[model samples]
Target: MMVAASEILKPTGQKPAALTIDGLSLEFPTYAGAIKALDDVTIEIGASEIVGLVGESGCGKSVTTMAATRLLPEGRYRVTAGSIRLFGRDPFAMDETELQDVRGKLVSTIFQEPMSALNPTIRIGRQLVGVIQRHEAVSEAEAERTARGILKDMLIAEPERIMRAYPFELSGGMRQRVLIAMAFSCNPGLIIADEPTTALDVTVQAVILRLILDRAKRTGTSVVFISHNIAVVSQLCDRLYVMYAGRIVESGPTRAVLEAPQHPYTQALLRCLPERVEPKAELEAIPGTVPNLLDPPPGCFYRPRCPEANDQCFAKPPSMAPAPDHIVACWRRETIQPSIKASEATQ
Candidate 1:
């Protein structure tokens, strides 16, 4: 369907596109010129699927989210071209009233820091009750009760007491639990969890992850879990999409991608996982830093750091053609030596 289309600075629609992004592009105008935050990006999340958005910092991950949600400040960034559709309808073209109806009720976000996401001065119960009533039409007392119930599911020892306390009174993990509670309260079609566990201890991180995965399963909620950690994604996501310099370099089923990485960037990511590999073992890092978004490499963004880069790699953007179910944007997919053969070749 040709959904409503909005102007560069406008926002549009409510229903989720099953959610598809077609030829998406976003840029920021600076004194120098335009910094390309996203370039010809395309992705789709099926209903109830947990798809991951994986990348190192500055790969345009967060920028992609901000643009998708129309959360960007006016005039600060620009959507030069493309569509952000939910349910095949244009979110950009939706009017302000429609946008408000869609954003939190149909789509919600869990930020990297809970403290930043929550109001420090307000009590947790008030915040939770307000969100529930805003979208759900529940009475304040009923919403407050629902909030306590969700907090209990997070395994909080005293959900009632915790709800009454301010965000500052709660621990970091406690605050995160409350965030998850709020997100679930709406039962949104899609939930964007951006680095959701970055602020807590390792033990608490595991607990929060389990709670997220468990609750998501029961709700059958489609999620876009953004993270720099591969191990965490492996545990939660059904599929993985790896980004590099504002484009997706690799995407596939989680287990297959983890076991047999086809792109050099994907390989480097797995090789750098400290938890899965030995502590004393030498880690593999892509040699160069990510290229400047303002003037990204002419061809492949990862060409400078790819060990197997060839003359052809510098001449054109690699195609993300299908290789089984996985789509890879590397010229060396066929050339990647099998792990077993590589070991023998080394010997």
Candidate 2:
């Protein structure tokens, strides 16, 4: 295996940060020209921080993760430009074998679907053992022991028996736990969890999310948790990046972004939450749908949907700047205050 020797999850915590993505823009060449899936996307994850990439469906959040890991599928997608550096190594330039080592050993991932991720034909133990043995120079017996230990740590009961069973034999929650075990088995520096709880129930989701958080917190494993649920992001992320279309419209400390969103899109997203936001009141909703990415507008992609959008929004693009750690890309954010303020006045 060709695992990079410099991953950040070292026991001493002395390694450099896990990743740094700069002005990353990934485009897909369709028959209808380039679809700008990611427009100047930039974010970072420290060695031990859990950052949330929050956005609506098809906002390029998952695409960003897939591109960063060099896992983009055949012909359907192409990265026109951008840089994704993992442990200071460029993922885009790495060879296939090199990428494989980085994927399972240094940086692991958990997809939205657990059943598909876990092999149906193989026993759970065999799958786990394969993952470990793929990276480590260990005998089958040793690999099996390590795999069993990892599963047990994930709170999987009867690890020995569960390992011997197939993926179909386990419940959904159990299957998710097994996937989590696999991701963390290599002691990866970064875990890209792409909506890890989507297939799980509410209570099960909570348990799984908590497990992920507790594991990362204990292991000092940095995570890039991508989800469309703002409420969930509020609970788990130390920092939040709000994506609209293909760009980051707002970003800041989770509390700041959640409590006092600055951008029109951000405010709209908060308003769109279901009823009972406060102690005993119905929640407001954000009006309008997301912009089309295949043929994005001339200026701001959100102009059509932004309540505060004006001539300037259609004139030229707005740049990110001094909005505390918080940032808003709306042309009228300077004059746009969250409706939460106006709602209080009426009350």
Candidate 3:
């Protein structure tokens, strides 16, 4: 049986959330007019909590986090609206110098591909040491010791040998572990893991997930895990936000959302899970493709593909909370309250 995240995650006190993105709307400017990449996106991650951002490709999951970290290229995109507070400081107003300090010291990112994230020319030791030394004031020898310690903590045997090897020398899984070590080397307040295990096999993927949860829980670090895999998110995240066509269609505690999904898009995605199907039966797939953002239709972007969409869906529905802490943007939300309550009662 899968352990619930509520059982393992630390309790967040009255302190402000580690990260907050409110009413975020951004567009990428190109020769073919602006493409609205994010639409009124909002998310909050509490201290020491693990939140999952799940969606199909082109749903703006990566863009939302990238914009929060100010990693998107300069002058190429426009934030039409929204504010981001990282540990109570506004990242949008920060300068490059301040951002440099914030990126590694306060917030670190574990990219999807380890090879692309790690430098091929640099040895793993030098790269790890560089991150530690850059973020905190320490001697070269001291940084090296810290790097080695972290590598050992990651369960990378023969730390000395591994550190001396360049990025190209290690396997994908090993390189990813190195990246995870580097992300945790400085003990950042939050870690954004953007599909860090996509390239690995199932066994390696499970190990990577366990390592991330273990380390984050131990260090009191908050994490925003971004992925298209709802099954992985269900197993690991305390809270989940489901996105469709740049807008958050559903969000709540993981168990709550998974047990009684309110949005049609979410239900469709869940149906696509292989575990839900009979053995040897054909897998289900969401019928329509994600909408084009450049010339998106008015009101709900998902209405075009939603099976349950009605006349009310033509005009975007306001967020509704049929259950406490469970929010969905669907005109039919009120009518589903009875089913949600019955499910809860049974649980």
Q: Indicate the residue-level lDDT of 19 in model 3.
A: 88
- Deviating ranges (above 4 Å) for candidate 1: 1-17, 275-279, 338-347
Report the Cα lDDT for residue 111, model 3: 98
Model 3, 1-347: lDDT tens digits are: 22222223324656678888878899999899889999888788899899999998889999999998999999999999988899999998999999999998999999999999999999999999999999989999999999999999888989999999999999999999999999999999999999999899999999999999999999989999999988799889999989988888888889888888888778777777666657788987777778788888877777888766778788764453444447777777656542332244233
Worst 10 residues of 1 by lDDT: 2-11
Model 2: per-residue Cα lDDT over 66-165, one tens digit each: 8889888856776666678898999877888999999988899998888999889999999999999999999999999999888878887799999989
For candidate 1, what is the lDDT? 0.79
Runs of candidate 2 with Cα error greater than 4 angstroms are 1-15, 275-283, 341-347
Better of 1 and 2 by lDDT: 2
TM-score of each model, in listed order = 0.90, 0.90, 0.92
> Model 3 scores what on Cα lDDT?
0.85
Compared with the true structure, all predictions reach lDDT values of 0.79, 0.81, 0.85
Number of the top-ranking candidate, with TM-score as the measure: 3
Q: How big is the positional error of residue 96 in model 1, measured in Å on the Cα after superposition?
A: 2.4
RMSD to native, candidate 1: 5.8
